[model samples]
Target chain A: MTVAAEKQPAVDRDVCIEVSNVTLRFGGVTSLADAGLSLRRGEVLAVIGPNGAGKTSLFNCLTGVYRPQEGNVLYRSRGGREVSLLDRKPHQICRLGVARTFQNIRLFAALTAFENVKIGAEIRQRTGPIGAMLGMPWVRRAERVSDEHAHDLLAFVGVQHRSNIIASALAYGEQRRLEIARALATDPEVLLLDEPAAGTNPAEKRDLESLINRINKELGVTVLLIEHDMRLVMSVAMNVVVLNFGRVIASGTPAEVQGDPAVVEAYLGTPADGGDGDAAPR
Target chain B: MTTLSAVARRARWWNHARVRRIGAYVFAGIVVALVTGPGGSEGHYSNGLRHGLLAPRVIPFIVGGLVVWAAVELGGRQLYRVRPLVTTVVSGSQRRWQSPVVRLVSYGLLLVVAIVYPMHISEFWRVVAANEIAIYVLLAIGLNVVIGFAGLLDLGYIAFFAIGAYATAYFTGRLPIHAPFTLNPFLVIPLAIGLALISGVILGFPTLRLRGDYLAIVTLGFGEIVYEFAKNQQGITTGSAGVFNIPHFSIHLLDINYDWGLPSLPYYYVSLGFIVVVMFLFSRLENSRVGRAWTAIREDEVAAAATGVATLKYKLMAFAIGASTSGLAGVLFASKVGSITPDAFTLQYSILVLVLVIFGGMGSIAGVALGAAVLTWLPELLRTHVNPQNRFIYFGMLIIIMMIFRPQGLLPSRRRAREIRFAEAGLEGADALGPTPGSGLTS
Candidate 1:
């Protein structure tokens, strides 16, 4: 059993994103305290926590949206450079092959879903304003590539039929899927999804679970997700980290952490505070 | 805390809401009366208060205010009732107008009218069209790039215009500090544009991150700084004595060597050519990936950044491009007018250009150009037939009515209309001008 557990992380693959000793604070509130997690290449890792447990904060830190006061986020680029993500801006971090979706949908509301996804796909394009203005053939080729990629991504996320719809006009579930499609457009080696299944119906949740599995298995992309849906998490996640009050309380295989006493105590509340039996993150 | 709480509790409503609303109209009347009334230059008071508070002038303002109130109160219900119908008809027509055949025909008609109308106008009106209207229209198109495409509020756009003018002057050896070698004003256009583009980047580096109001204030300051430099720097810009004898645009080609002399017709044709070229190029830019990045940045900066768009770089590019256009207009203006003063590039021109963009419909290139034409032409018409002194009062009223009725200008871009409608409808995005499926570059 010990040998199998030790060999679970394949020796050939490296960590895609490694967060270590990260601490984030907002004024007097310490949002994440000495919290850390590592996402191995081509695997699904879930960070499960109650409301305000700093799961989103951790995501922000990794994506360069929130610069932690201490600690480092190291990303291994496809070029094999172990680059530090701590000091870079969000766009620079994205270029280094890490993309993320927001907990609340942050799709470009005014743009069409196809345009929104194209925005991501076109990041790899080298066309300048002058080139675009002149309608150069090379620029056209770049645009066509991005357009084709946008089509494929929209299809992959099952929103190809609604690709022309304005992003804000999309149904909530479709918006969620569209957002995933947009993040994928950046062609990231690692995709960070913050509560992708938060408001989704059971059927949509099931769909998301399969999509996530496909993203990991077929596309060979690492995924780090923060979720509250135990069924979806257990079904898809290979590893789970439980956080409470900005601290990582337990981490292991989904089934192992499900039965851990510390994770249970954190979720159900402790004796010092009046215990809420099910402290769900909404 | 106790004092703050006490102050907060002192909620005062002196009259019923309706009475106060009417009274607000009355107050506007008094203010307009004081401003537009015959001044103390002709009156008894030394400081020129107008003494409108005591006379018939005050009565007119008060009457105007009451008229406004009547329109709001009486016309309010009718407006509310007709709004949906109006929106339906407007949107329906807007959709028809988007077809390729309709668009081509409309553009052709507009071009025909533009070319023919100038020939029939009086010489004075022709000069106004060539000089004032064309200049303002060019300035408006440049500003639309900043405020509409990039979503950056630039109140100091005229600063870039002034820079272009000064560059032309310097290049033509008209400034107090002469150029190393004189260049034809035609040849100086690119050089002046480059100068303005560079200045735009310099200004944007520190101020673009300020966002909205703060960004506006910073640009306003920059405009004032340039204006002051031109006005007071005797060694450089001749200290408001102005730069003169700046030669007009000419063609000194291999076979044709002709100076574009005093007649404004030549200037009009050349300026029209510039406008057409700019419109074509800008439309292409607006439909490109660069334009998409700008729209993305405007919609959600964080999302744009995380999606690998260099948001700041795209913003700077927009600012610089807009500035370059302003520079081009300045070069043309300087050469055609054969002179320029600091007074010509004041803060007033900046606000006027902004008004043109907003009145034209922010993002629509055709709309902005049309807006400039109409607004500038109306002033000339008023100067000829009506009292020009009170022209702004008419303008203020027109704007107020427009804002209350069709906030989307006389002509609006199809995409910009969607943006405004979505905002008003809480992001439902009931698309105006109908939907064009399979997006990306479709817009």
Candidate 2:
């Protein structure tokens, strides 16, 4: 009951996405209970927790992949207007500029790397069915633009060399990068990356860190990343939210969260002397 | 370099170059032989050792055709390399329209040939060509939906053709409904389409979950079941004896009838008109959102669905639409023939439709039309002068040779060729290395 009351925060004007008092129940099990979070524009927020911390479920709820029965998910659009993402279809939500990547890749395997990126640009196509039928000049122009933009995005992610290759044929790291590029191609104001460093080698992870930093600093794009790698979350994120058993244990800058007693208990499961905190950098 | 090492290095270089050169030369030699051989002069060869082993007339055509085919292919390759961008753009954009235009022009050419040629041909040849073109155009359009748009391999599409024919027969033949029960042939068209749609849904529902070869097998079974039912059902279908005097289409107001006695030319024009309309509709559908969804589903079903495409619904729509086209063709056939028999719709018809779709280009509407025209004309050309036993052998050989040489069909769609290239690129480098050193095959 204490956990339930502590989770729901009153809505604020700056909050772009507000998940309030959400509870996800599947039969007899509750995956997330009274879980709440708020995302804002031009902020890189990191959500860190162990396996069943309900991070992905929270992401699913925010993106309209699943509609939580108990609470509301309000997304503020690019026009400084707010709408409930739960009321819209996944594709409609995507059109409203919320894009995400999967922890396990879900690319179009049979399509070329370029085509996979192009599908993300489907919502941006200006041509109607009639234009495509007639091969109208306007449609052709739009197609050229889309292809150029797709190529540029792939290059930004350093996978442009594999543009014509089928997506399934790419190396694992390249595929991961391609997925991110695809998400970016949707031209979303906010990007959600799930485990960007999960299977990446050290060299690739370093590159991913720089990429995330560039996306935040130069592009001014809001990034909400759920990463299990603590070093990545601590180093790159401006703010960190720690979760345990679907409830936020602590929320602050990396330094403040590092000192929280509850955060320690959540990570180690039981509290001991805090000396070993340096053993694994907070 | 030492003599032995230098010799070994030369041998390695020779092996690589030799294989390629041999392939090229062999290809060229076949072409040259076909062009210069007796076919050019219309000479005949007689072999007393075995009477059935050779046919004088056939040998010339086959050899000459091969030579012409090879020279064109070699020329095309050289042209492609010399002006890559021009060829790519021309081939890409023009390929889509080539089939329909080619078909229109070829029909005109045939008309000219018919008039100018010194020798007089039989009336049956004209009938055969007209019927073949009409039926094939319909079949190609039907198949264009399943294979071209939806990318579903349907090996037994002829079942719908049989369904259409049977529906026409049952309605106009012996159905004891009302007083004397004679449905207008025009009315039977819609009825046939409706029946085919119903059958399409029935067939599609169970096999919706199936993909690739499994789906093909289930469809083949469905066709066989339909065939067997027609064969055994004597009370309704009249069994193997079939129904007779089904009645041809007539317009009393226009004063047209079997006795009004229009020549086959009028029927040919009508068929041509229908083919044009179908081509227009197919072209529109191919470039629409529905077509893109079909291509997306074909490319990746899971990704398509994830992008908010209703994959199952679109696929079923494809099947139903395709079956309806076949049904429409069947109605025409039944009305033209004035009778219906199960023999008219067989596995061979299904394969023939598939061959037409493939020979044109799977996803290209114009290619399908061209394919229909060529295949239709080829048989007629053979039957006019060649032996019946050898006609099929020639046809089979032609298909085999085409598959080996030009798997993409005569006028391969640019989009489909790109897809094939992408697939080949993925497989080529890995397969050529010939399994790892420790692999079972190498060991």
Candidate 3:
């Protein structure tokens, strides 16, 4: 159940999220079995797996969409407060500064791209419902701030030009970018993207990689993504966790995972004749 | 050969757009003439084709066709250019009236017209129509919150109206409970609203998880339960006999005191005031953060939840606010009529209000208000001309035709129009959170 064999990556920065031996089950199905991983404060970590390998389930557990029956998902805010994410609702977790994009793009389709991002920024405003209705001075100010922030995020993700167009009407790649912009609008300490480049072309995927890099390197926000594309995973992620059969089979630098016989076997179903791990017992 | 070719060319003229347009007018005129003409007169001569062409019946058809053709030529050409015309008029007015002063003046003029309307029209029935339509406008606006804003299809909205009416009766001592003191109908308004608000919560809390048709059925059942209680609650509701002698709205200020008369003017004014207030409030709610939350839930509940919106709280809030409007209308209805009956707040009333919201444009306040006024007054306007037995049939036909032509309703909100338009165009028919959001024709 432990993915600790490889030497741990250098922890020069704070750890944003710490998943401790989380296990989730639905009826008789074990969606995630004793899975654990830690996301560094400003590093891009990739969770790669084959189809039905429980990467999304693990994402759900982190986001509070699916509460793990056992173990803790902890969040460490920038202010240095460690909060248990276990009994929290999705929105509550979001408010604590964890924002995520869906595996399938879940942009508000009927809303304009600007509106979709504005809604994301809206949660950050503390104005009460009454204030919003009354258009109180502070609420008005907040709305202005929210609009500006949303526009900036859109610009950051390269979808500012499509601001007024409905999300559904956007090109597939543009919609993916808009989704990222919306997530960023939450002003999160950590951003979790579930397959951001799922349906995008190679050029768009490259843009996504650079976007993740910029979000991590420039903004210094932690980035954890679930990706299936090996090249995208290796290029963007500073650390990698490979899941096979609802468990983490490998955790290391991309090169170490590539050389790990367990990771190769999970992906290709057969070990190489000269695989280094062949010297070790299963 | 030349003569034959010329005849063929003449025959081809029927395929021309202009010729066909005129032909359509001629055909409509002939049908009207046939329908309105007196039944077959005795002593008609033989030779069917020649006699039919020469008969006196032909004159009306020919004249009708000429008149229709003239009208089309004069006006229908502009109708064909309606899209451009509307855009020009709207944009042109926008440019001309850019100042707040000009906009304010126009709004003032509209307000003056609205206030002075009943004064100029002395017809008793017309006043009654105005009063009734105003009441329905309030109801439609309330139901719009639940069905249009929150996307909760509530079919039992009239139950809140009934609750309001009964609360008015009970508070005013019209009910058999016969309190030691009777309150003014105006005084009971707040109590009635509170009662309706409570009732909304009671119904909503248990059924918030249910959606669409299931929620609709549960609300419908709630309405039926309320109706049944009002009908057979024995002495409390006075059973089917209902409460009589319900007090009218009265004001007893320091110097002046007046009791409302049975005439419809006072009631119409009050209802109009309520309608205006409700419209203002609902419109404000529609644009605010709470409104955004409601729309988010409507668009996708799971996504809304994920974004930190408490779906249950907002859903219940929608019910409370929506029900409170109906409660206000109920108090107005009980006071205006001076009587209360379970039969008055039947399932039909619920459906009628729903029809108004849907017909007008669910999320559009102006649309729903217009829908309420038009649907309520149309029958009265047509009563003299339309056959009594066929009036309902015609009404149903009109609704069906309207829905067929404009599924988004008469005055759809931009979002609703886009959703329907996209669906029709095969662009994005399925919703983003729909069961098959990822499984679509789009790659």
Q: Which candidate leads in DockQ?
A: 1
TM-score of only chain B in every candidate structure: 0.78, 0.76, 0.81
Q: Higher DockQ: candidate 1 or 2?
A: 1
Which lDDT value does model 1 have at B60? 76
**In angstroms, how far off is B112's CA in candidate 1?**
2.3
Sort all candidates by DockQ, best to worst.
1, 3, 2
> Model 1 chain A: which ten-residue window has the lowest total lDDT?
A273-282
Q: Tell me, what's the RMSD of every candidate?
A: 7.2, 9.2, 6.4
The CAPRI category of model 3 is acceptable
Model 2 residue pairs with clashes: none
- Candidate 1, residue B103: how far the Cα is off, in Å: 1.5
Question: What TM-score would you give candidate 3 relative to the actual structure?
Answer: 0.85
Q: Residue A35: error of model 3 in Å?
A: 2.5
In candidate 3, which residue ranges exceed 4 Å CA deviation?
A: A1-14, A26-28, A68-71, A271-282, B1-107, B178-181, B427-443
User: Docking category for candidate 1?
Assistant: acceptable
Most lDDT-accurate candidate: 1
The predicted structure with the larger DockQ, 1 or 3, is 1
